[model samples]
Each structure stands twice: as structure tokens, then as C-alpha cells.
Target: MRTYLAARAACIVFLFSGSAAAAVSEEEFAQLRAEMLRLAERVGVLEEENRELRQVAEATVSEVQLARTEAQEAGRTVEEWAPGTTFSGDFRYRYEEIDVESRDIRSRHRLRARFGAVARLSNDVEIGLRLAAGSESPVSGNTTLGSGGTSKDLYLDQAYAKWRPFNGAYVTAGKMKNNFYRPGGAGLAWDSDYTPEGLAFGWSGEQLFINAAAIGLESDSRRDNHTFYYGLQGGARLPVGDTVSITAGAAYFDVPVQGESSFFGDADDFFGNSFNCTDADNCAYLLDYEELELFAELTYSGFAMPLNFYADYIRNLDADTYDTGWLAGARLGKASAAGSWQVGYQYEDVEADSVLALLRDSNVGGGGSDIQGHKLFGSYAVARDWTVGFTVFVDNDAGENRTGSGTDYDRVVFDTIFKY
Candidate 1:
């Protein structure tokens, strides 16, 4: 544009200086100069408008790119939501044999399968559900194989919701997992598969922990018919040194026995607890359970294999006799990964009324109280998520008083388990 303006100015100057000036008037030259100035101003306005349009186009392109990026990010957020929901399960097959003195030996092939799902609804809330292949037994999930290949049944094992109101504290409701910690993972006070229905509270810190629960044993609209179990436990972990630590805790549990028959057992059943016979066919519990428990565990990892020693003691304050029970055990190594193995031994003496009969270890003493036993167990991880194990229980009925009333009981179990 500058070059065009300069050429126009030169042409006009040449025209005026040559013979054309003789015929042209001064008025014509003045009009021509004014027209050239207006034309230059118009060109400058057009250039400014063009620059503004170019900037607008660049900004529109940038906005479109940003919108596209945001859409992709929204798609990824939707994909990430599914990961917050997870599924897990395990399967176990076992061959079990039990022998009782003066009785025929019993053998069975049993299998247990459990599938569970957990959904993290938010940062502070979660929901869980599980299904198990077995009968509606709180202490066991196993189904014996028999009945000419009849199809097994599935039962609702767990349905619960958990909420974390703050750091290191949580509340659980519904038919939830047992919230109390079993020292040494022992089933002296509570069974491994027991899912109690009610509300539970728990809190844990670096070295201290507490658990409490209100378990619903039975619900009846009739007065004094409802039964509930209440439990509270507090513990602390203390470090002896860098390679050794000790954990100790105490717990109290109250189980109400209001009627002759409860949800767990029939009127004729005592399960080694003291009972009074109302008639030839009816019996009632003698006392309510007020159990106090003490537990301790010591772990040492200074050697090639870790060693763990644990003890559990319980006393029913409501009973005068057969009220004390205790167990001591030691375990060497851990079978957590492939090619690893573990071996453990434990001895336990549980007199009548020491703990609740239906809630204690079902695998010992024919699933009742008044038992003294030695348990030897070992496990080997054959592959990832797969393990083989065995347990042998040499137990006797402590309630038997006659000379060898022939109540010696022995049980052996071999299991193959797979987890996913």
C-alpha cells in the first residue's frame, strides 16, 4: 500500500510538471490531493478491521480445542468410576474325618464358596454384600457333599454399610463382619464365620485400638423376649525393640439368656453350659454370660523365619465353676506367597460357661463347650492365590467325669483353597 501511494504521488507530480499542467487548473490539483488523503484514511480503517477479525478467529480456534479436551476428560472420569467398585471371592474344598471313642468314624467331603462385592459410594461411605454356599449357620460356611449330587444352596452371608466419620474411626451396621479382634486370630471367643447383625463402632490409632458392638441375638415383640449381646474391647501395641513387638488387650462381653429356647439352640440343648431340666424334654440355661477375656501376643523377627507366640484367657464372672478357659499357641513362618509354608500349634482348655457355646469355635469339642484340645496346623502356598493346608485336632470332652466315659474326639481336615 505504501508503494502504491508513493507511485500515485510521483505520477501526479510528473503530470503537474509536464505540459499537462498548462491545461490543468489549480482547483483540479487541490481536489485530487484531497481525494488521495481520503483514500489513504479508508485503507487504514480497513487494515484495522482486518486485524480485529484475525484475532477473533484465533480465539475461536483455541476455545474449540479447550472444549474438546474437556470432553475427553469427562469421558475418562466416567471410566474411572467403575474402579471404585470391586469384586472378590474364594473357594475351598476339604476332606474332613472325625473319630469319637465308642462311636463310628465319620467322614465327609465338604466345599465352601464365598463371593463378595464392595462399592465405595464416596470417600467416607461404603457398601458390601456377600453370598455363601451353605446352610444358614452362623459359625460355618461349609456344605457337606452327599445326597446323590443334589444342587447346593446359596445364602446371604453379609450385607452391611460402613461409614468413616473421621480419620481412624468407623461405624458399621447391618449383618456385618465381626468387629472385635481375636488375639492370635483365635476362635476361642467368637467363630471365624460369624456375622452379627446390629451396630458396631471402632477406632484405631498408631498404638491404641478400641472396638464395641451391640449384636442382636433375637428379636421378639413380646416383653423380655428380645435377646442381645454386647461386647467391648480395648488394646494397645507396644514395641519391645526394632525386631520384636507385643500386643495386649482385654475384652468384656455380656450375653443374655432369657428363655429356655433361643435362636441358636433348642430347649433341650445345653451345649455343655449348666442347665436345669424343667421336665424330661425341656431345659433352661442356668446363667447369663458375663465373660471377661485377656489376650497377648509376642512377635519376633530376628531369625530367618518370624515367630509368633500368643495366649488367650477367658473367665465367666457369672459362673462359680467351670468358668475359666485359656489357650496358648505359637506359629513359625508365614504362607503368604508362592513356595512359602507355615506351621502352628495351639493348646486350649474351655470349660463350661467360659464362653458362649454357639459363638465359640465350632470345629473344636463337637461345636460345643467343656472341651480341652490340642490343634496342629500347617499351610503351604502352592501358587499365587492358591494354598493347601491341614489341621488335626486331638480333643476330649471335659464334661465327662466317669472313668474314660469314652468321649475322646479327634478330627482331621485337609483343604485346598483358591482366592480371587
Candidate 2:
């Protein structure tokens, strides 16, 4: 019995000690689990921070690349905006000698000088201006003016603004040469010797082109009281092929005459009688006049010798008359060729009762007998920007009129031009 009791006691003690050790071990395991959970949370936070930093770095890199691309594109655009800006000018000096067979005596030598400037103001605009100084010698006569005078009267050969607002439309204003007839010598026929201040508007599209304007006129001895001269013109250019073009145009002018009397020897005389009538009864005897001009031209640039043909008709509304003229010409020169030449023949027919009759009857030897004229011109490129040229002009009446005698006139001109 004693042995059994001792063994039982020892077993009880062992059970208690084992229970205490299990409790302590459980506590240590709980602490270790807590530490492991904290470590995991810290590692998760670090991972999140790394992901955010990577996103930020990627965003910054993308922004920098975009900026670089935009800068390069802007640089390319600037280069294309203004392809070229060029400066160019020209100088022309002409010496003329004249002999009038009808006047019996010859005139002195005349000198002329002209300067011009052409500039590219912008991608769509161009500007030009010119200054000329010379004696006013008639193409056929021995009269010269403004020879020894001051050069203060510098004419504005071209002071205008041009804009290409659309793909095929252009507008210009401020004292430009009028576009009346086709772009040829005939087109320049009515341009004022002195530049006139005016406004011109033009429109051009794929199939059509039209230009119109109104201008101011300077009063002269003939029409001393004239306030303004207005004109309207329209033109159309049609392309027949890659190198040929046909153009047609019409022009009208309205002029008011005041101050001075008698139509003879007056510039306004071509329109109608210049008699000032204070009473309606006297005004009934005067004829009101308006002038109309119609013109057409054909240009061919495909051949070895480019050819141009022009025809024009003028009608006096009140005088009930008409005049017709035509010109056929060719330019046989190349910009890179050694020699260049231009030859033309012009025929101007004026009836006995036409407006040109007054100029004919003034003994200016230009009227009344069906005037025919011929022109021969040639030019040689002595240097890159220097050229020398000569021209001869002759006019003769074919002797078809029985009431008036025929007249004949001849003229020769030489020119030298240098440009840069």
C-alpha cells in the first residue's frame, strides 16, 4: 500500500509540471505569430510604396517624351512656314535719239533711268515698288519735257497690297496697274503716265478670273474741271491645254467734264462736244458719251517660239461709232539661252467718224487712213543680270481714203537693263 501511494504522488506531480510547460510554450508561440504578422504588414507597405514610385517614374518619362516630340514638330513647322525670303531689284538706263521728218529738225539726245524693287513680304504676299526719272519724249515726235527739272516728281510705279486669301483667289488695292485687257502691250495702253491712286479688287477660281477697279484722274488743260474718273473691268482666263490660255475682257469708263469749253484739242473731246450749256435747250444739242472696250487674247507657250494674239474693239456710246485693233506677236527667247528676240505686227483700223479721228485730224499723222504698224525687237544677255535691246516701230496708212491723204511715221529705241 505504501509503494502504491508514492507512485501515485509522483504521477500527479509530473502531470502538473507538464501542464505548466505547455502553457509557457503556447505563450511564446503567440508572441512569435504577432511578430511575423507585423513583418508581413511592413513588407506589404513597402511593396505598395514601390509600385506607386514606379508609376510616378513612368508618368514622368512619358511626359518628357511628349515634350520632346512637340518641340521637334514646332521646329519643323517653322522651317515650312517661310520657305524662302528673297530680295531682288533692277535698274534700267535708256538713251534715245529721235528724228521727225515732218518737223524738219532733229531733237537732242534723251536719257532715262528706272529702279525697281520686288520683295516677298510673307508666304502669301508680295510687294513691289519702282521709281523712274527721264524726259517725256513722244514715241514719234521731237518734243521732250521734264529734262532738266528736279526729280521730286518720283512716280509710284507700283505701291499696292496683294493677298492670296484662298487657294485660287487674290485681292489687291492701292494704286496698282489696271487689268483691263489681256496681259500684253494692249493692257498697258490705258495706264496713266503718272500713277493714279485707286482701289482694285480681284477674284480668281479654278475656271474664271476677274478684276475691277476705280481710279482718280489728274485734271489737265483739256478737262480742267474733272473731279474723278471711274472704270470697271472684268476678265476671264480659260486654259485650253497645259501650255495654252485664252483670255477675254471688257472695260467701261465714265468721265465727267467741267470747266473749259470747245472740244477741239481737248483730251475730253474724244467723248463728245465739250460746250457748256447753262440752259436745257442748249444742253439738248450736246451728245452724252460713254466709252466701252472689248478685248480677247490667245497665248501659246508650248512651241519653240511662244505666240500671243490680241484683238480689241472700242465703241463710243453717244458718238455711235466703233474702232477695232489687233496684234499678233511671238517671243522666241529663253531665260537660259544666249540670245532672245521678240517680233510683233499690229494693225489698228479707225473709221472716218471714230473717236480716233480727232487725233488723226489734229495733224498728229495718226488717223483717218486705216493705220498699220509693225514692231521688231531683239535682246542679248550681255551678263547674268544685264541685257541690251533694240526696237523699231513703223506706222503707215494704206491709202484707201479719197478724202484724206495717208501718213507715215517710224521710230527706233534702244534699252539697257540690269537686275539683281
Candidate 3:
């Protein structure tokens, strides 16, 4: 439009002027029109480029938004479980050999499997359940290979509720795992499989720890026949320096029972054909022993591997006969981290009626109180949360005066375990 207006003005000036000095030549008008055409063409090209750029920017934003949505959907798929609810368990395969003195030594293959889940409501309260592969036995969770059983059997190993009402304090009840402290990794006083049915509590400070519990061992149909077990333990952990620490504790257990219907029954079969009680039905009574135990452990980390030296002593406070037992051991390393290894050896001398037979180490001398043994064990963590382990027991039945078995009874166990 500007070009047309300028041309009209130029024609008017040429038509009305008497002098031709200001008149525009035809050639000049033609040049001006060509220049205007070139300018308009450039503007049109710039406008088209701007439009294409806007479309590209919109498409890039849409693609980015789509990617973000897909990422959020994938995250939701993995966030299915509620917070504080976790699942974990382990499975073990074992081959065991039981060597007896002056008798036929037997060997067997066994297996153990466990699955557990825990749900936490808050920092103070949680509930857990566990399913284990075994019949209800205090000491043994092993399933014998080729038992000809039609179906696999599983038992509730642990069903418990735990609460921490305050700092450094806890309460647990139901058929829960043993809450008592084990001095040297659990073989001395209680079997690994022995989950106690009771209510237990613990309170701790910076260095001092206290524990107490009351457990129902056997419940009779008749009211008075009910049996109970009670325990109280206290301890302290003291660090000497950067490399040395000591842990010591004293514990007392009161078991009040005497009858054919003993604590959990002799199905544990700790006693052979000759049991202390003269009952006809497979020695059904459990020998009542009130135990008082003191234990101390010393750990030194100034070596290639951490070293722990431990000693545990127990006396049956109520026994009129044999009344004392002790165990000493040392272990190198914990064998917990991947590719780490551990080895340990323990010597145990337990007198008859010195400790409760129903709950002690089942693999050593058949879980009897009248036994002495040397236990050697080694373990290696092969992969993450997996381990291969071996244990050996060279024990003898030592009744009062060591007259029960002059011969040796040995046992060996090899196992591989995987945990998650």
C-alpha cells in the first residue's frame, strides 16, 4: 500500500507541474515496485518459519508431559505394599549324621524352611507371623528326607506382637522368639528353633539392660496341672576402648512342674529308652530344674578378624544332685557380610539335672542335661543373604559320676541357607 501511495503522489506531481524537474521517470517507478515485491516475499518467508517453530515447541512439550505420566505409572506399580510392612524368610537344606557309641551310627538328610511377614503400625507397635516347615518340636525344625508322608506339614513358628511404648523399652507376647539374651550364639541355653510362648519385656539404658518373662510351658486339661516358667535377666555392655568390649549378664529361670504331662511332652525324646522318670509311657515327665546362669563375652577387634571369647555358667539352684554346667568358646568373625567367613569352637560340660533338658541345644548329646561336648562350627557367606555352614559335635553322656556313656557320640551337620 505504501508503494502504491508513493507512485500515485509521483504521478499527480508530474501531471500538475508546469516544470518537469520533480517528475519521476518510468524506469525509476519500475525499480521501486521490484524492491517492494522483494521485501514482501522476505516477510512472508519469515512468518512461515515462525509458524513452524511454534508447532515444534508444542510437540516437544507434549512428548515430555507424556513421558512424565508414564514414569509415574511405573512408580505406582512398585509401590504396592504399604510402608513399614515387610516380608522376609529363609530356607535351608541339610545333610546330617548322628554317630553313636557301641551302636549303629545313622545318617540322614534334612530340610528346613521358614517364611515370615511383619507389619508395623508405628514406631511403637508391630505384629509378625511365621510359617515353618516342621512338626511342633522344641528343638528340631528339620524334615526328614523321604519320610513317606503324603503331604508337607507346616507349623506356626512365631505369632507375636511387639511394642515399644517408650525409648529403650519393649513388650512382646504370644508364641514369640526367645527374647532372652544368648551369650555365644544360642547353642548353649536354648535351641534355635525353640520359640517360647509367653510375655517378655526389656528395658535398657546406655550400658545396662534388663529382661523378664513369664511363659506357659504346659497347660493341662485340669486347672491345677498347669505348668509355668519364669525368667529374669540383667546385663551390661561395656566398651573398654576402640577395640575391646565386654558383655555380661545374669539370668534366673524358675520351672515348677512334676508329672507325666511334662513341659511340651517327651516327644522331644531327649531321653532314650532309659529316662529319669520311671513312667511307662516313654518317660513322659520333664525333670524340673530351676537354673541360674551367668555369662560374659569379650570381643577384640584388633586382628584380621574380630575375635570373641565367651563363657557361660549355669547352676540348677533347686537340684539336690548334679547342679552345675559351663561352656567356653571363642569365635572369629561374624560371617554376616558377603564373602565373609567365621569359625568357632566351644567346650561344654553340663551335668545331669544341671539345666533344663527340654530347651537346650538339641544337636549336642541329644539335648540331654547329662552331657559334655566340644562343638566346632564354621560358616561362609557365599552370596548376598546366603551362607554355607558346618557344625560338629563330639559329645558323651555324662550322668552323675560320668557312668552313662564312656563311649563317644558324635554328630555333624552341613547346611546351605538362603535368606531374603
Best by TM-score: 1
lDDT of 3 by residue, 1-420 (tens): 456546655754554465543455767655655665676666567768878999999999999999998887778632264677888889999998888777788988878899988898888999999999876777778887785755668999999999998999999999898888888775666777889987999999999999999988764457544777899999999999999999999999987654434445544354321234454444444456688999999999999899999999988777666678889999999878898999999998877667777788877776767778788999999987999999998764544334743457888989999998
Greater-TM-score candidate between 1 and 3: 1
* Higher-ranked by lDDT: 2 or 3: 3
Q: What are the clashing pairs of model 1? A: none
Per-candidate Cα lDDT values, in order, are 0.85, 0.52, 0.79
Q: Residue by residue across 53-152, what tens digits does model 1's lDDT show?
A: 9999999999999999889878774337576788889999999999988789999999999999889999999999999998777889999999999999
Every model's TM-score: 0.78, 0.57, 0.77
What tens digits encode model 2's per-residue C-alpha lDDT throughout 1-420?
Answer: 346445555644544475644755767756755665565566667768878999999999999999998898787742355444334455555555443446553433434445655466777786656655542311211123444764433444567777777776666766555544444554213422334456666676665666665655433535543345566777788999799898887877654433433333333233222234565323211333355677777888988867777776655565543233333455454333445545555545544322323212211123232444565666777776778887565564433342355445555667777776
Q: In lDDT terms, which candidate is top?
A: 1
**Candidates, ranked, TM-score:** 1, 3, 2
lDDT for model 2, on a 0 to 1 scale? 0.52
Q: How does candidate 1 score on lDDT?
A: 0.85
The ten-residue window of minimal lDDT in model 3 covers: 266-275
Per-residue error (Å), model 3, residue 52:
34
Error of 2 at 46 (Å): 67
C-alpha lDDT of residue 238 in model 1:
93
